[model samples]
Target: MKLFNWPNIRLVLMFSLVVFLFSFTSNRNSQRKVAKSTVIFVGNIDPFINQETVNKLLIENNQDPQSIGKDKLDLNKLEKSLNGHEMIEKSDVFVSIDGILKAVVKQKTPIARVFNNGHSFYIDYEGNTMPLSDNFTARVPLVSGEINKKNKEDLADLFRIIYDDAFLKKNIIGAQIMPNGSLLMFNRNFNYQIDFGRIMNLEHKFKNYKAFFQKAVLDSSLYKYKIIDLRFSQQVVCTK
Candidate 1:
């Protein structure tokens, strides 16, 4: 009986019309063609890979996607390819409703540069090795002389400590491994060497050095010493 009600039928028809219009609009938008593609390197990307490099990578993979159908472009594959780059830590590829293909990438950061034998390369913060870039050289702490691959983690940790302390980072320029497996540190501002010995007791050694340096600075005797030994426990030994 109520199935013929005028108001109910009118409301149902209006709802159906709105639903049909929304579906039509969505389908039309989904089929729109891609107009352009853009690559964005998000973090610390300079001196490594640039926009042109990323664009070339896309072209190589045939994923340039300019003027192509948005629905046909494979964004997942684009991301996968970008992530495969050694310098790229992570990447995200996506397309907007206006058919603009975009990729955002994150770059890896290096903590130390190593010179072993005749080869030179960078060691990332995670202890991973990275190739040097001809465009720019990172001003991180240099590791020369003999380098032991077995102590990679220790080297990484030493760099991290230097990076965290602004005073030490600015003063300490390089390090070397002696024949006895001991370590020696050099400062840019001072002509003397720091006999760091082994990598252990870093916190205690740096503290002793800091205290001794403060005293030496007051007496204008910092440059007079040639070697400041921090190998002993809770003591600093200096030689001229």
Candidate 2:
């Protein structure tokens, strides 16, 4: 049998230690490079969520990747922070390898102006009540009369008619809600009144108005008529 050599065992142990040290040093250098090159991408963020705010929050919360030795920045917390604002509709965030941040934002679009009691609010396309801003003016039809409670569905339906029905939208300047829940439309150009009751079968009613206007008003000199009542189904009454 060959004899076991103590010096040979020591040499082998030393070589293994050297290899481990080299690997550890290489890993440390790779980590350092990654830490030096990191960038952040922030999307759907407004000017309110500026660079200073981001820097302050990150530094205050100790969320900076460089401070924590992280390969990627945690954008979830940043997004949550931005979404806390009432004006922010949506926000997205991104990060690059060089530690730079990019942000993009989408804002809510108002569809109509809603008034209740003495205060006024904007109704967006989605029928959500948006607080009026001093910086921007909403270019939408005004609604008034007995609007005390929230009526998103009714308001949305009215907006749909305004957007889809071309002739009616052009002719109608404003809408009023009666105490008994009937809808009244006023024409600005013609100085006529349209009594649209309770929005039921509105599509059919609007179609009838189109046909009646083309045949009765446009074809003849009936613009002098004061009221065009289409509240009753299958009939249109014009008063001079």
Candidate 3:
């Protein structure tokens, strides 16, 4: 029994040494190869953030793959740099087994663009304010006139509801903020305004609007009204 155990232990040690040597040699060869270029994958281009812009950013910072080697590349640092950009919502950088460096970036999506007192910016989906991009302008709902940064979070909630509904999203094109902090929405196809007062009882207001809208459409009176007020409690008032 002692003789058999000694032979088995010797064979196991020899196999482990062979595996370690092979792994070490393969790792050394990988480190010797330098990254030639970066492969970028953008999930949503949205005209704001593009592949060229990301590549240019890396080049400007001297972090481009052309200057990076597998042995010296810091994936965590690269990812952190990309995430620091306001437009980039998230980013991932990784070096493949074939010595290729790849980066996947996702840009933020804005639901509304605001313009007030010559200042312009965007409200992202998460209710965060982002500066307007010089590269491209998103075709989202434009909010102009008296702007209140304090109620932006509430406004973002309203925008989310309108943007989510396919019917409302297609119909509303812009909005105006009244001095009383109420919202006035403009229709794209019709020459009418929706007086969407403060952010209260949103579900009830939207439901009333839908019911009234369906009734108006059935009666062929959609274009006849000039103003639809949904500020009341479970009631829709139209002015012609």
Candidate whose lDDT is highest: 1
Q: Output the number of the TM-score-best candidate.
A: 3
Better of 2 and 3 by lDDT: 3
lDDT of 2 by residue, 91-138 (tens): 675544454454444555566687769988866666677777655675
Among all windows of 10 consecutive residues in model 3, the one with the lowest summed lDDT is 32-41
User: Candidate 1: which stretches are off by over 4 Å?
Assistant: 1-18, 146-149
Candidate rank order under TM-score: 3, 1, 2
Residue 201: error of model 3 in Å? 2.1
Model 1 agreement with the true structure over 1-240: per-residue lDDT tens digits = 698699999999999999999999888877888777788777676668777777666653464567567777777877788888877778888888787878888877777889999999888867788888867788888888666676777878888888778888888888997777778999888899999998887778888888888788888899899999999996899999
lDDT of each: 0.81, 0.64, 0.80
Q: In terms of TM-score, how similar is model 2 to the real structure?
A: 0.63
All predictions: root-mean-square deviation over Cα?
A: 2.6, 8.3, 2.4
Estimate the lDDT of model 1. 0.81
Question: Could you give me the TM-score of model 1 versus the true structure?
Answer: 0.86
Instruction: List the lowest-lDDT window of 10 residues for candidate 2.
Output: 37-46
**Alpha-carbon deviation at 105 in model 2, angstroms:** 2.4
Candidate 3, residues 104-221: lDDT per residue as tens digits?
8888878889999999998888888878888888878999876567787788888788778898788778999888888898988878799989877777887888788878888779
RMSD of 3: 2.4
